[model samples]
Target chain A: MADQPTPFERFIQGILPENPVYRQLLGLCSTLAVTNGLKPALTMAGAVMFVLFSANVIISLIRNLLKPHLRIVVFTLTIAAFVTIVDRFLAAYMYQMSKALGPYIPLIIVNCIIICRCEVCASRQSVLTAAADAVGQSIGFGLALCSIAVVREILGTGMLAGFRVLPASWPSWTIMVLPPGAFLTFGLLLGLVNWIDAVRSRKKL
Target chain B: MEQQQPDRRMRLRSGFKNSNLAQAWLVLLLALVFGSALAAVQVNLGHVIEANKVNETLEKIPELVFGADAARKLKQRQVPIEITPGTIAVEKDGRKAYYKLFRVTRDGTPAGWVIKARGQGYADVIELLIGLDDRAQTITGIFVLEQKETPGLGNNIGTARWRSQFVAKSTDRPLVVVKGGAKRPDAIDAVTGATISSRSVTRIVNRTIEDLRGRLIPAKIEFSERHG
Candidate 1:
């Protein structure tokens, strides 16, 4: 077996090496839905960070007490509670954004990344390790979402962050802001990540 | 064994540890803990959320009634008008519909009236803030307060350009939606590929004007009579 990975490795692995969005492909529901705009994507990242981190810490604390059969229920209840807080917080403080994101914020309760982390890492790992893993995975998810958002927003509306970056004459690619655009961008980027990984491994050998 | 064994309750504690019901007890305890935590959050943030919804409508009042350009000019002078909210209940065919509306006043004279309304759209209910002129004979502007229509298609109903079609439409007759077939005097161009959303918005605006036109004119006439 490979040498045991410390908390730092787990943290770094989630960032790029084992990115939740690009490599693990967890939580793609949010990644696809909110990546049309940079603002929504970043907001989603902020939300996922809070929910994932809290859920991980709570699960790690209760790891010893959780029954094997009933653990999933406990994890879901904890995650749902955190998601509700986030949803309400956004509605209170950031009304426009909350309206724009609508059901997507509440939808985070079912987001695979949080539950998967609880089951795989937080269930057995130390609280510190689980916390680090949660942060790294969320950051990786943010990066993937932003990368897709930047491309889509630029091509879809000839703008970046609501400012026109492309020449005015550049015809907007309306399809890029649609759902198919998310799939296309994700597939191409996944292929690109794989290609780079393949070359790096070949050099190492 | 102890000289005096405790009651069955004490023995059951040890027995319960190995029983299947142990998990159920743990689940119940966790539910109680988490339920209270969620209740705390709702109580803390609920009012803020309510205020946010109200503030959004209040802030859009000027732009909804005076046209965007005039609203901007009014804001440059630090929003001189005071908006007082009131209710208008219109009965049709033995049914009552109550409207929460605002009277925008500057100094002492009323500037306009803005009403909150909602109607079913293609996906979900679309909420709107509709503005009317002083006499309520024509629409000055409209703003989509909330909608959950299809993204990139039906959602165009909220765009300023699409909503502008509702501006300056007379209340004398109901507005009609046209899908590039014919441009009549009272026809609004339905958003391409989103006729349902366009139609729903038209229906809502038409209903608002139809219900309030005569009622508002009579109220304003009374105010003018007193000042005349």
Candidate 2:
């Protein structure tokens, strides 16, 4: 019991040690689908943050009441409701951005990251602890999406969010913006994060 | 194992009052609450969402009629562009397909025509607002209104460079998509690796121009073109 991590430690680990994308490999569908451009990736991250944080808080509050068999059902219903509201809001207010994101916003329901966090942290932990976990995981997810977007957008279009970051003459790599670019970037970044983790652990030993 | 704990706590013989026996009440409660929330959202925001789509197409009218740079100048100078919406039933292949038409005029003069057209693309329906000169003799521009084609490949149909091929091409001949560079008149170069998508757009534009040329001679178009 004494060796148990503090709530803050649990929160802190999600950012790097238990990153949903790189560390746990959860929510890769959106990570790959939206990372071709920076704007869409950021928008997706924002929506996910809102949904994940809200779901975590509500689930943590009602943890004791949750039936064992009906737990997954509740998570799905809650998430679907949040995602529907988000989709409509985006369509109404941020129409262009919503168009760019397309069906990916609705697809956030199946993102595994939120569900995994709910089961692992919110279902057992205090409300504050679950919230901290949500925030931390959201940041980690955002970072992962941003990194992939930056790499793909720069190499693919020689631009970031419509601004030309590279020279005009730069021949953009066609593959970088394609769906395969997502897999390529994900593989390399995953390797990089793992390698860094290994070095830090080896140093401690 | 966790399911057994609920059965031990059940005191009521009737299943309705007992929380453990009536395990699905929580789900029913959550569903009702969430469903109501969702219904409220849809009722309030649904119209705005539909309006957003219409407004998006309206905003693209300027760039579709005039060139992009000219469209910017028109905005700066406060040149009022009028878009009169009308629908035209054009016979496509074997069936009758209707296309929404926008007769655009700058101030009091007929500038060009923009037609809303859609066709089957590689993965999904691709909607385009195609622009043509007042006489419907040549294409002015094209703007993709909605598309869900393959990312990075078929979706390039929306890019300015690819769409530029249609501009100034004569309406006398149906447009043809070529493999590489299209030096021949009435021929468009296909988007590399997206031949199907490229062909789809070409088919849509060609079919639209052929059907519209004879039908779109508005009385004001000729009068306005001759005088101003």
Candidate 3:
């Protein structure tokens, strides 16, 4: 248990124990904003994955050369560079999706999950290990976002991704698509995760 | 040993001498790289973005003027008017017939036009394409474009049933909206729920006609014969 985990273990930990949104709760603002629909959520998740993975590998490669005092500044600069690249790439190719996500895409620079991984996992670990950590964490983040989107989209519009999933008779809840819906959905999901963790712990005891 | 100690101190001082300046230089270099990259991207996409905006505006204008095929042959020609306010003028074969201008923006920008004899409907503002005969001050044909009132009650503005009433109405006299239906040559029926939207359309048409007779006819700007 004390030894470093294998690549597979690292990946699993990303979705559960080290979950960036639920377990770690490092970055939640963009998570809530983009989770209004499946498409926006998926796009944001992909952008975050790309930036996180690239930044981690680069940080690990230059860890030794980076002075301890200037480590935070270097890590931030690396993250910002990767975020800018992703932002521009999306704007050039997937212009519509970029417009839908708007300012949140660039705000990924301040996403603490990316910076945390750089400092804790990438800065000390090998490049391969850092890459594994990035992939694992990204998967976890994606799952969290998709789960929230599913509930919000279903109740808000009585549809799934734009396809009507609910019956015509069903009354649509307009509030689910608004700001309050984001808070309610996130709070409920957080509570459910905590409850499940507690029950599982009790069974073990 | 004492000489060696002084030499070591000199080396340590040299190592820390310009660290602040080096840090500042590093920051400046990174900023320059980022700034240039952003400028290049903006220059590349600027024209395409502008073209898309213009196309969107062109598409909306015609729909707001005349409904369907009537506006199909409509061509928009930008005319410079000295009124200092934005307005729309209708013409046929170089003679001005009908014109209307309204403030769509608070900053004095023209938002839309109301043409004479656009038709009467239940509710909502009905936009029209007004044209006149070369020698006559009266309007020839008024094509109804768009309206938003009540669906079943006010939507009659767009229907052929309510619109056909204006086919032969004389433009020499002002049009009026009546509760049951207009008995006069220049009157039309107003929908029950959408009386306000219907009245708004009638008022716009009347005002536009007045503007055409008072100002546009006397002005040097000539209205086009064909709608564009």
Q: Which is better, 1 or 2, measured by DockQ?
A: 2
Runs off by more than 4 Å, candidate 1: A1-3, B1-26, B72-80, B91-98, B120-122, B173-196, B217-228
As a whole number from 0 to 100, the lDDT of residue B181 in candidate 2 is 94
> What is the two-chain DockQ of model 2?
0.74
Predicted complex 2: CAPRI docking category? medium
**What is the C-alpha lDDT profile of model 3 across B1-228, one tens digit per residue?**
999898877766777544555545544554566567656765776555555533333443433333434445433333321122234555646665434322111123322232334444444346554533332354444445555454334555656566555554555788888988678778878865567766766676665665565444325444333122
Regions more than 4 Å wrong, model 3? A1-6, B1-228
**The CA-based lDDT of model 1 is what?**
0.86
TM-score of each: 0.84, 0.87, 0.59
When just chain B is superposed on the true chain B, each candidate scores a TM-score of 0.78, 0.80, 0.43
Q: Candidate 2: where are CA atoms >4 Å away?
A: A1-5, B1-10, B13-17, B20-22, B69-80, B92-94, B106-110, B178-196, B217-228
TM-score value, chain A, candidate 3: 0.95
DockQ of 3: 0.11
Query: What pairs collide in candidate 2?
Result: none
C-alpha-based local distance difference test score of model 3: 0.68
Best by TM-score: 2
Give the alpha carbon lDDT tens digit for every residue of A74-188 in model 3: 7787788778877777776676577568799999999999999998888888888889999999999999999998898888768877799999777767567666788899999
- Alpha-carbon error at A11 in model 1, in Å? 0.4
Where is model 1 chain A poorest over a 10-residue stretch in terms of lDDT?
A1-10
